[model samples]
Target: MTILQPFSKLLKTIEPLWKIHFEPRVPAEELAKSRTAGSIPSFGFFFLLTLASIIATLGLITNSSAVIIGAMIVAPLMNPILSLSFATATGNWALFLRSGLTIVLGSFLAMGVAFLVTVLSPWDVVGSELLSRTRPTMLDLGIAIAAGAAGAFSLTRMSIASSIAGVAIAVALVPPLCVVGIGLAGGSAMTGVFGNFYVTNLDVAGGASLLFLANLIGITISACLVFVLQSYGSLRKALKSLALGLLVALMLSRPLGTSLHEFAVDNRVQLELHGLHRDGRFRDVNLIHRVDTKLVNGVAYVNIFGAANEEFIEDQKNIDNLDQRIFNAIQPMGVHTMHIAIRIAPIEIFEYRNTSSSYSYQP
Candidate 1:
């Protein structure tokens, strides 16, 4: 049999527990009607979608987590996505078309609204919120899968309907669309900006799009799995659709894997720097204000910014001595080549006495 046969057998063995935790709470007819009702397109749905997109775009531009969460709570896109998976699981062609169109059109509408906002807004800086969406790893995929499963499970139990808000926040549908809008609108203007750091909006948009697609596919497939397990749909059809979703997720894993590696490298670089600071006599020197790492031509470059005693700044020999130590600290990491640039700010120390105050300087 297939590699999954053993797992399937295991699931069958725990069928009773699965029913208690995940079985459908509503009748099949009621669930089908609910999905159909949610799939129907209307002006109200589009209006809410547009509003949520605008709010989410603003939130991302301003780096406001609260505003972004608010947008997530208001987003109507989740229903259509769930319905699409449900339709596929049930082999309902009409419902599938209805939900699919809702998702496609709604996504475009959200992106269009975000684009218009970006074109008109004076803010040119890409904030942390926007940048976070541009990088998706396997961790993000896992979150989406878990969120999707939780979302599907929540829907079946009316007592847990309130938990959908948490799912919305976890999956984060609108913000990525907003990032796409910002990327599309910024175009060439996105280069060499404060937050952008010479990365083009097109590149940012592509990454964000991949993230959004991963979330979409992950949610759809996971929800399909839940529906099948709950016995709400055609098991054969659900398995087929689940296979397609898994294939798409597999394709996405390549990039996500690369991103994960990059993330690990960055973390390792930071950890190495932290260890150096802790072990060395560099306690008087603050190297943690800002640290930037960039890789070019197979060599890693690090830029550290912090303040030091003014005396340290004035003595070129002493500064050179410290620089050598910094280099030595990073050498053990096994990087073939690395360049470290240090930016030191002078600090003035003031001593207050009974009569007069004395000042000392260090960099």
Candidate 2:
């Protein structure tokens, strides 16, 4: 106890910086009312969550990012999560359980709505937006933590609460759950390629659920920390929930780390390909048409497509030598096991003829 005196005094001195405008910004009574309102089991909450789920599901199905962002804005899911953090901070058991139950029920309700909509719709294709949420990285966790802190701080300042819409955009609480439903609706395996730790044989729904779980835990933990700093509750009271959140984050770290590493490898491979394009060795093939790289189960799969003049595409030896050079280039970058497939197709350069206004190919 005697050893902790200096630290205790130090914390008291720096509490203002941590609070970010401090208490009495919103009175205790009004704050309690806000939290209670969030925790209430109301028809409005369900309506908003269900509607948001439907919109997000359709948005993901159509690969529309704007629609998904709109869904994020309309989601009521953030309020209950914020309330959960507040309950944990204050050691309010009834409020904690009530908020938790609301979150769980809301998640399932969203999923149910998504599943029903997916089943009714004929277009079951998995779009890029849907695939993105199926993979979560440390970057996503970082965003959720920052957004949670911003959200909690906003809640205490009535004037700033309206800006919480931006927090909804940052945290992304609803889309993942809706993705889970879409995955389940298809009943097929959804594979995500990362480094050696790629996920296969798992359905999309299961993969998306992992992302949702990560976001939920990240937001809850960060919100609790912010509330504690604001003098809303004792750190001791929120320990168990915080511990659980940290444990989940720790468990998620392995896959998230693998994804980050894979992303780096992907970028490096693209840069090397760009260097090859700039070297002018391709005989008038000045542009790289497409480069696709996927790392799966310790192997990198590279598909390179280029457009060139007919003469350039006709050289069999050049194609073979170029393939060997690409293989050699990536090898120096620590990519030992990779398969590079190159496809060169003729690009017809068109010019309008003045005589007949007809288009003719040049070279």
Candidate 3:
């Protein structure tokens, strides 16, 4: 009667011979205990990782999907992660530690090399492509969880391991981290390093990078649950742990995330207000969500396209004042930490003119 069992039943009906197991190789609570004991990578592992990083960097630069997929396949970043999940579920702390380290080291190394390559690559700075990888969401976390489960299932069942790996690679693990590092190397060092760019007096931050980490945690937890569900046969215990973990995350994520965001925005505002604070052109403010998470020239930019008016423009005295005010508004939310480009333009409202005034000039 479990929520997932129905889907399992459906799969069995569709393909009676499908080797779906109700229990996984390990239980859930143990997965939480998994850790990475520092271990050196085998020569082969590093070699593949290096190559994959190179290819992924090229793909990022070219903004090519094909190339990116290719790199994902070669990267093989998900195995150790999957192994870590297994180790976690099984209460094998030593294996879990080893696997965790493998994932961290592999992911970081790939990203670092990718950062250098991207910095030197001949490519236009495509913020969207970069931005896409930066922010993760609830949905993304769902994908990670499912992917982890499927991956564990496939590997343990001796099923289509290759296909599962392919799927997991495509889903992502290394590329986003690589992009975060590359964002810094590609002249976004200031914001990228701290993870935000604020140029104007007002802006916000903490949009995407945190989301990426959220997704990672989601996937890890989901995989842990799946491992327990499919392998341990102790559904009661696994459910208990899974429920507790999720409750904790749910309780902690929003406030913690919001506080972090505010801190970032405040930092950005402080930076801008340091030099220019007198006649800044800004006043009452509301943050536009779209351009709130991007960086250019080592500063966060907020888009005031919809908020600008002649008051901030015509009043020369409001330049520094406006900047300060605007900064104050969003600084608490990191509106300046990301892509908070504030453009000064008159608010244009289309007025429907009555034809009666024109009097048919052209007969």
Lowest lDDT block of 10, candidate 1:
192-201
* Candidate 3: 10-residue stretch with minimal lDDT: 195-204
Tens digits of per-residue lDDT, candidate 1, 43-139, equal: 9899999999999999988889999999999999999898988898899979999999999999899889999999999876776678789888888
> lDDT, candidate 1, residue 216?
95
For TM-score, candidate 2 versus 3, the one ahead is 2
TM-score for all models, in order of appearance: 0.78, 0.78, 0.56
For all candidates in order, the CA lDDT equals 0.80, 0.80, 0.57
Judged by whole-model lDDT over C-alpha atoms, candidate 2 comes out at 0.80
Clashing pairs in 1: 308-363, 309-362, 309-363, 310-361, 310-362, 310-363, 311-362
Quote the RMSD, in angstroms, for model 2: 7.2
Residue 74 deviation, candidate 1, in Å? Answer: 0.6
How far off is residue 265 in model 1, in Å?
Answer: 1.5
For candidate 2, the TM-score is 0.78
1-363, model 2: which lDDT tens digit per residue? 699999999999999788886545677667777888998769999999999999999999888999999999999999999999999888888989999999999999999999899899886566668878876778888888899899999988777888899999998889999998888886764443322123345457766887787788788889889888888888999998788878989998877766665666656656766766688676466456546565666677777666677777787877777767666766654567878776665777777767856787999
